[model samples]
Target chain A: MKKKFQNSKTETVVYFICSLVGLLIVWQLAVSFTSLQKVMPSPFVVLGFIGQSLTQKIGGKILPLHILASLKRVFVGYFLACIIGIPLGILMGCSKTGKAIVKPIFELLRPIPGLAWIPLAILWFGIGETSKYFIICVSAIVSIILNAYAGASQVDQTLVGAARMLGAKPAQIFLYITLPASVPQIFAGLQVGLSSSWMAVIAAEMIRANEGAGWIITTGMESGNTVQILAGMISIGLVGLLLASLLRLIERGLCSWNIQGR
Target chain B: MSKVEVNHLTKSFGSLKVLDDISFQVNDGDFLCIVGPTGCGKTTFLNSLVKLYDIDDGEILINGEEVDLNKHSIAYIMQEYSTMSWLTVKENIQFGMKVRKFSKEKLNRKTEEVLKMVGLEKFADYYPEQLSASMLQRVSIARAFAVEPDLLLMDEPYGQLDLELRFRLEDELIRIWQETKTTIVFITHNIEEAVYMSQRIMVLTNKPTKVKEDFVNPLPLPRNVTEEKFIEMRNKVTNLIKWW
Candidate 1:
């Protein structure tokens, strides 16, 4: 049974790789057959753009600068979200008082889309990295809050009872049972935050910033540099994919004991 | 001398009284099993003593001292399969010890002792997801034992298991009880399990429950439930809970 499960996972990884390769092949073929370069740049054109960006000197108008800029915003925004979200989520899950206190405002405000915050963020923090950081942070907080809330709320009450029975203080029970169980679900939230960071970067860069991936695309559109625009989009995809895979790898390392050689 | 005592446990849940004027004392080295119908507040009474829920009026004494609700030194092995899916079997076994802050040597000794006692030595490396339900329950039992608790409280610990595994686990429980001889208060919905396992079986009345009977199991160790007297006693207790 275990062997079959392992085989199926390997099969899944292979299937995923094959599908990605197939998409790239289709993209290359489409570009080759038609005058698609003006609208849809070829994968080779995009790769070449990436190669040029990568090999260019530091702080050039290329891939590495935008990549670094985007990374910075995502890290800051996500870090801020985690700082606020985790404690509030655990508190909400653990206490009726905390839930009652925060729930009304949370429900009322949660529906406002992260993009909608752009105007207000610009007004509050101005049209700079602050506004962008605000957008990214706003986009991330709600999902992390919701996921952490769920993870904490859904923790097995029996485990808490068992912990109490086994000489664990109330705080100890929360620390041991509530925190550990919430990690997988919290990571799920982080994954969402990661992908959404791409959108946030664009929103943040909609303001005047000469040093970002979002600015690259915005500038490309003005100059009619379709290759650069396409390259920026592709880079976002690659970076998002890379970050997601990294998160999964970290989760596996943290929870390796969970499934006995997962 | 008694290891634990429950005095006039009259507990009411707002309008309804779950445990009414109930009392019992558990001696050190005693294996006291409580059995009753589903709605007899058997669990409520147990939870009340442990202060899981507030009791309307009761005093629980342990080791001749008023049992401290805040000090969770007594180990409770729950009935349901509630092992931490994130933790491996060995980690779960080590959890209570970690909480108690035992010395490394002590933790190792206790963990080894309990895992071997429960016959879960070979599967120590397995996770809860990898183990069967019965095995998961054993890990819980192992965790409780690893703490070397002053009191072991179990609520229908083997209720989910099939007959063969239940009986085998019961044998394991008996061996551990014999070796450690700590005070125990076991709660079970099954009449036969109470008869087989307990030195004394305390039965409760319907919600607003009180002690209806506290039976002393005279049956020898390595109990034979198939025997005529065993069946007779089971039937008598079965009627006690089933009938008014």
Candidate 2:
């Protein structure tokens, strides 16, 4: 069984690499043969620019430093979202009064996109780090809260009853039963929120920032450097993939029980 | 060990009566099985006894006091495998003991005992999802028995298992009951299971469920289902529960 699982994993990685290579080849061919090259750089040019950016500075900072700056902004906003959203979601799920009081206001705000909050955030906090954080928080928080609420509310009542019968206090039930049971769902929320925060950081940086992946793109566009823009996009893609994989690894460690064929 | 007395038990769901004017008593160290037809409020009745469902009009007393979980040592095995999916078998078994703040020594001792008894000692580190259906049920059983509660409530715990697995589990339960001497109030729709396990069988009628019959089982322990007396007893309870 273990051998079968290992073989399956190896096959998946092989397929993934093949698909990526296939896409790059298709992109290279299109740029070489079609009028699409008029607007965009060839895949080779973009890839070379990305490799060069590793050693050479893109703006005042290296590519990694720009990514790090965006990461810092995303981290602050995403962290704030989690601490606030998880508890609030649990409150909404666990208490009728809490839900009744908060849900209407939440519902009213939920439909508004995080990008839409930019103007208001700028007005409220100015076009500074605070504004960027606010925008990213707003973007990421909705999914976090929604997923956490779903996790908390969906806890099996039968388990609660069983806990109570086993001499669990109300607080103990919440801690031991409600909290652990909701973890997988909370992780799901975190996954989505991280992506949202990453997207928001780029958008925020695009509007006003000296250093970031978004800044790299905006600067590249100003100079008509299509290769540089593609390089920035590729970096974003790689970083996004890395962040998602990192989160999945953490989730695997924490929620080993929820995984099948473990 | 605990004696349970339920009196004037009544429950309704938005004017639809489920259990009506029910009353019964379970003596200390007795294995009492309550059998009824499907949807006859057997679960509701058990839930109400455990105070999982609020009684419209009733009183449930454990050892002469109202059934308060905090004050009473009680364990309930739900129809669904209520094993904490996030926890391993050992952790699940220790959950109740941990909640009740059992001594480290007692906790370890009891956990080991129940794990061995349920034949889940090998799977102690395994999570609920990793286990088979019967193994999951055993985890639930081990978890319940680890607490060594004064009263144990089981709601059709083996209802989902195949007959062979069910029989094996039944024998394990009997052994556990004999060794522990805990007062058990088991609820099931299977009359033969009730006859096979219980020292006393209480038959409940259809909706607006009342106690149709409550009788002692004269059949000795390590009962033979193929025997005439066992068949006679199983048939008697089956006839009472037959709706069609």
Which pairs of residues clash in candidate 1, taking residues 3 or more apart in a chain or in different chains?
A167-B72, B18-B208, B18-B209
Worst 10 residues of 1 chain B by lDDT: B64-73
User: For all the predictions, what are the DockQ values?
Assistant: 0.58, 0.88
Q: Compute each candidate's TM-score over C-alphas.
A: 0.88, 0.95
Query: How much of the real interface does each model capture, measured as fnat?
Result: 0.69, 0.94
DockQ of 1: 0.58
lDDT of 2 by residue, A168-202 (tens): 99899999999989988998999999999988987
Candidate 2 collision pairs: none
Chain B TM, every candidate = 0.89, 0.95
At residue A120, what lDDT does model 2 achieve? Answer: 85
lDDT, candidate 2, at A232: 84
What value does the lDDT take at residue B210 in candidate 1?
A: 71
Report how far off residue B203 is in candidate 2 (Å): 1.1
CAPRI-style class, candidate 2: high
**Cα misplacement distance, residue A252 of candidate 2 (Å):** 0.8
- Residue-by-residue lDDT tens digits, candidate 1, A1-262: 8799899999999999999899989999888887864478777877887788887732355577778888898888878888888788777877889999987888988999889998888789987678888888888888888888888999987888777777788788888899988888887887887777777888788777887778778888888888888777788888888888898889788777555325
